[model samples]
Target: MRTSHPLWPAPFPILIPEPRGYDMVAKALTIAGSDSGGGAGIQADLKAFSAMGVYGASVVTAVTAQNTKAVTAIHPIPDDIVAAQIKTVLDDIQIDVVKIGMLGTPSLIAAVADALAGYAGPVVLDPVMVAKSGDTLLADSAIDALKSILFARATLLTPNLPEALKLVGEGSTQAQAKALLDLGVGAVLMKGGHADGEICTDLFVSRTGTQDFSALRVNTRNTHGTGCSYSSAIAAGLARGMALSDAVGHAHTWLHQAILHADELHVGQGHGPVHHFHALWK
Candidate 1:
């Protein structure tokens, strides 16, 4: 009763094969603020996406007049304009993934949520609260709305230590990030860049389980847009169909390298930005 066909390949393998080709170009859209500094927000997003070899698009929710030092001002775009930007992009392009960051107010949050609802692509949210220079970008009242509308619809949430604490309530930690996964979002990435230690660790949690990713904590003061870069990288990976954990892992790795590479190249007088193009010259 043994029947083995010569033309048939192996029946099955637990290991998955890597996808190949220009069938590989994935599209990622970022709905966030404009960082005048060119280190965070939509600026960092598009750079990260391009560095990762994926097409990047953006819809500006707000305009942040800032630099590596501080966010001088945040001007939220009109709700209609924000919605129109999203509509224009989505109508013509097939977005494979979405990365959301710093919506200045509750109204912008609602507008972004409504605009994104129809697109069932993977969504990554970076709950940007305070800027690296200690300036607050998002309004305090917008916190609840971000959680209710944007977080609920997200496929992944990238929250730094402080943002995680706020989202899951103050005094929250790695344990609280696990609790975040139970809140209905598909996954949560709790970044440990703000932690006081020799190693920088990022925690990725989901219904399946929790995974910790860490690297040698570089002692560089130029970490302006780390959160934005990380989330956009994750979105790019997701657009390429990488599993959630795999995407998080790749993002962490890429960000770690970026930090190390930016260890010397001075840009701004204050906190500088990671050299996103390091891979090019290396």
Candidate 2:
């Protein structure tokens, strides 16, 4: 019997489409919150994924009424709903990389960790403990939950100075990043953007070793979403099959450009977002 349907011709073409410019196209998933302000969290993750040439997917764990100025409110989604979204996506998509951010509660943290446990892929854990405006994002109890659950499962842990301080303890320095590697984190990128200096040097520490990546700090006050952007770019690179060190290198490249171009635009009443598409437009 000849299978004939209105939707398709009697004979479909068997030739598959050619691969794109790169050797592969990576698909990445972001499990985080919706930034109504559109500069951080899932919003920044998606933009970073797109700008870095990866397919982007997301599961929103919470919704925030926030802007560049501050996070006004956060409504955490139920654990079951968060799990369902993750399951649905994993069941259908071949997610190459996973970027996690802004899990605001202990329950949500456990749920995300549980869901991700089934998929052993490259994972980037951005410990988003506080907002750019210094508003607390993760609950006091949730920090412990994140350490026990998400931090151990991640392939790369990306934390800013404040987040690293919270996770490891206050007075933590670049030399102390290795201690986090001992805590079961496969790798760690301690972002130097928060530190006071003429050159922002991000320290990449891993079981193999430690390396420093620095750039002349762009003298712009509009540095909102910088951490999220950097972490998401690394996830994008991972999805594209880059090594951890190489991925971080690529991410730093993207971040440096984002900061340099940031001076050309303004988005809010306070700290503004990076220019994610600076290279593309220029």
Candidate 3:
């Protein structure tokens, strides 16, 4: 014989619910320069990460004075400050993925590499050499430093045709990608947007195998920040626990849609930026 409470049934066993835990948000860090026009670099990376539903953090290595048409000038931040920024963020927040872009100087590159030496998460390195307007964002002398300091540690290196060629010399996309992979990078996404073809073909080469992604090229003048956005999107996917191939596939689709809808916004007189918010508004 047992006494029952008001909420309990007689002769029934008590049922207790398990305690609930807080949901953790996916977070990504972008170590890059700042684009004043808000189309590329840290701005584009943060936007892309947010668009993919990932929390975004950034350490601005340099700041550019430019519009969509051209990069007028770039002022690189001090190496110590850059390193401090990286340290501050990593010490407080749990970074799930990292997207590196536009380290304008060798010192900045080394600083970033050293700061991230012990980070075990995936890193997406976009070898951003030139701006959309043909302005050189990276110094010619810093190429060797980048290769030595960061390439081998990168989980994925995303390079446009020109950047890939600069890394591996003249060769087919597959050859260039293979050459880059030989440098100890876990993978390489060789973008073919700068090549001559109606369809843009991007090759993803990793230790496992090679996968090709192609899309019908959309003829448009508003193609700024494409590289930065693509790499950031891939980082976001990786932060969400997606596989490398799946992340690249999702980034390819996102970039294609952004390019297709780029003309929707009018910001500058020269080449405008892609619609980073296309999925949300359009």
Candidate 4:
């Protein structure tokens, strides 16, 4: 009955019982595309996860030729390959949350939806439709596929003003959030970066209630991966057992410092990345 792995040395003389998962750091899986710039997509997701003290795993759905300037070209991974990556990771890793980013095409979206069929956990979906440098990332045709296949399964859908408009047309932030919730997502985070004002507000809307988190918006060109990192931070907090409102608040507070410190970094000439490790660096 003692069928431990040969490489394992069992803990003999166990005197005290340990709490379940006490030794394990929270783990999250980011199923997204690759950003050659390292500012967004899987790169940003991993960095954000680490910054939040969460272990990160990744399944890349596409590879993009990109930098701070623009996303030049995108090469989507085959649906089967994407599915395999999801299966391989989910079969082994004890992931606590699933953070999904830019999934290029409809086929890849379907594949991800299928791969995550039975997974019952928190899913934070950041609708990465456009890059920082005004390059389109998601296909217009795939929007329907994403909503039908993944929205219902998502615990949080973080969308900026423009992306929310595309999904729900022109409306107030609250109206947009309600429209997205009507699409069957569990909750919606209406990001206000695109809106005009010194005071930035992110509205969190769900069936139960709504909460608005406001922060001093830092003015910086180094906002390349803000959305990606924000969503990952939320996922990290959720994995650590925080409520959704608390997780959103945590991300909002952390991101201000990151953006405030970004000017210290000299990356590409274009829109650079946020300082995901700002807390440790400063």
Candidate 5:
């Protein structure tokens, strides 16, 4: 028997808290190619996004039937379909950041630019021109289209040493970075992974000033998707509302860790992928 008090009834009833609404999750979109090998491109981008605790969406511009050894064949998605995919995602979801990679053709690049014309979210453009296996991913004709149509719209342009050289046409690293920054992109991250040096230095150039990030070169053949992982990690940081410089710094650290532990994973023959899940699983 329960005693009744001034603040209580004879029969006590248990009270439960009402369920709360779900919190809004940060979302990121990857406009890139599909790598069947699960190393680079959309797969790597999505993995990096997830590792950074962001929801990932993808719009595939092309599909490559390849492994760690080489890219055997590539089928570029139609421009209309690529545009439709981007539009559908944008129509329903509020994207926090967009990461672009591996537009195989000029039409596809133009289509991607047009689709993302009015998007206000931060965009990180990874001008992917060649595969790790030395396979041509983007045609020579598409380079001009990429610069003209998309450069102005990008919040950040991430190009490797080779791609930077191609964009600026034969110059020192600083000169190439300056030329790339002049293309109207808000910022440029010139990657030096391809350069032969004891320390790999990445240059982040903007209108304000330039920042240099250097790390010891991790000597390993398993560095296939370093570029993709770096750009997507930056996009992930941006989606989490980090400042541009902070985001780049975090991404640089993440990429270095991934590369440092790359040899742990055994995936395929030839140039394997960096361990994108190193932080999460380790």
Candidate 6:
């Protein structure tokens, strides 16, 4: 044990041992909330991280009494505790990328932004405003705080159609993507799940240009953690040294498969989760 005790071996310098489980492994950190239902939030993030072959760490901003059907209650973690979690994880782990989701309050957003001030690694911010069950996850008042505090620090912003409309006001997806880029995010992933179309086309919009990643829409109600898993997979790709566009492309393709196989789980009565281990499981 690496201990600090006045009585123990302080007179002689102690040899620090190498960190275990960090050799040549991609690492990712998730600063988000927890979902007890094991579908969304930190659960989904970790599942995606593992599926993408990245080591995952977490800092829980809040805890939700959530299930497939609804988020009945939420209790935000204390601001200091939240900050401590982020700081401790970052201090110990040389994380390649960070993913943030479900910051329900202005205080939590500010804490996360401040905690991540010196981190120069890529960050994927999934602005989780609402739940799959139509329950509001973020405070309406926290929208401004999210933009002002964390938007610029984020390498990519993954927002579904409804969230994009909420963030940038009424507009076409293209316009909303542009507006998000103007807000200082490196890029905006305009997710097309909610859009009515046979193909689910996600738009990658940035200052450079735009590209679309299209996949056949799988008809499945068991897509509860789509946003969380998608963002985490992108983070995992970045952690493994993939380019931004490549990461997005891989995540899009991976999520489609997960959604297509989601019905296999039979997790809950309402809005079951996508199969995070779709590729690995038999």
Taken over the whole model, the C-alpha lDDT of each candidate is 0.82, 0.83, 0.86, 0.86, 0.86, 0.87
- Clashes per candidate (backbone, < 3 Å): 0, 0, 0, 0, 0, 0
Q: Which portions of model 5 miss their true places by more than 4 Å?
A: 1-22
Looking at model 2, report the run of 10 residues with the lowest lDDT sum: 1-10
Off by over 4 Å in 3: 1-22
Residues 1-282, model 2: lDDT tens digits: 111112111221122223345566789999988889888889999999998778999999999999989989889888999999999999999898899988888888888888887898988999888888888888889888888877789899998887888888866565558767878889898888888978777888887667778777788878889888899998988887777887887778778888778877789989889888886774
Which clashing pairs does model 2 show?
none
* Candidate 5 C-alpha lDDT tens digits along 5-63: 12111221112122223476678999999999999999999998987877999999999
1-282: candidate 4 lDDT, tens digit per residue: 111112112211112222237777889999999999998899999998988878999999899999999989999899999899988998998888999999888888988999999788899999899998999999999999989889999999999999998888988898889889999999999998998988777888888888877766687899989999999989988988888877887777777777777888888999999988876774
Give model 4's TM-score versus the native structure: 0.92
lDDT of 1 by residue, 23-136 (tens): 666889999899998998999999989887789999998898998888888888999999999989999998989999878888888988888879988899888888989998
Candidate 4 vs 6: which has more lDDT? 6
User: Candidate 4: where are CA atoms >4 Å away?
Assistant: 1-21
Which 10-residue span in candidate 5 carries the lowest summed lDDT? Answer: 4-13
Q: Compared to the true structure, candidate 5 yields what TM-score?
A: 0.91
C-alpha displacement of 209 in model 1, angstroms? 0.8
Give per-residue lDDT, candidate 3, residue 147: 91
Q: Which stretches of candidate 1 lie over 4 Å from their true place?
A: 1-24
List the pairs of residues colliding in candidate 1: none
Per-model TM-score, in order, reads 0.90, 0.90, 0.91, 0.92, 0.91, 0.91
lDDT of 6 by residue, 111-142 (tens): 88889988999999999999999999998999
Find the 10 residues in a row with the least total lDDT in model 1: 4-13
